[model samples]
Target: MTADTSMTTVKVTTEARDRLAVLAAEKGQSIGAFISGVAERLPTAAELDERDERTRQALKKFGIALAISERAEGEALWAALDAGDDEALLKDPDA
Candidate 1:
């Protein structure tokens, strides 16, 4: 009976449905509208923090860690590149 607007259906547990209904009522909007608005809005800092925690947990489960290191000569190389001193580039044309 409602108009279709390229929307998709998702199934949630009874508890989740109840919680969403309560949140929507608090915002004076339907559950569908509340979910749509959240999808369109930018994520908040709290949301980003939660996302980062979830990512860290998932990476830990897979025994993965991201790390960065610099070589001893990295600063000189970067300085040369910044100064546009192409002598090094000429010496190592292949590089």
Candidate 2:
């Protein structure tokens, strides 16, 4: 990997700076390094939306053409999962 030795300053509120510094110290990283790692790992709303669409597309490709038809259905699915009844989600591909 090519190493680029460059530095940039960012301004934040004192509270934010202190909080970030504490978090960074806990992880044994400098503030800049910690922020860079977070940026690399965290997904923005648009990124999440794209991921959701791609997941739906993959599911559709497997013949699960119907997305959860309603919010209630989604909640029910979650309830099933919480109760360890996830078999409700499995279906014969031909059906």
Give the number of the best model, judged by TM-score: 2
lDDT of each: 0.72, 0.79
Candidate 2 structure quality by residue, lDDT tens digits, 1-95 = 12666877899999999999999999999999998889779998788768767877898899877454543476577888799986968843335
User: TM-scores for all candidates?
Assistant: 0.40, 0.57
Q: What is the lDDT of residue 54 in candidate 1?
A: 79
Stretches of candidate 2 exceeding 4 Å from the true structure: 1-5, 65-95
Q: Could you give candidate 1's per-residue lDDT for residues 12-82 as a string of tens digits?
A: 99999999999999999999998887776867778866766777678878997532222224446677878
Worst 10 residues of 1 by lDDT: 66-75
- For candidate 2, what is the TM-score? 0.57
Residue 53 of model 2, lDDT score: 77
Identify the runs in model 1 with alpha carbons over 4 angstroms from their true place.
1-4, 44-95
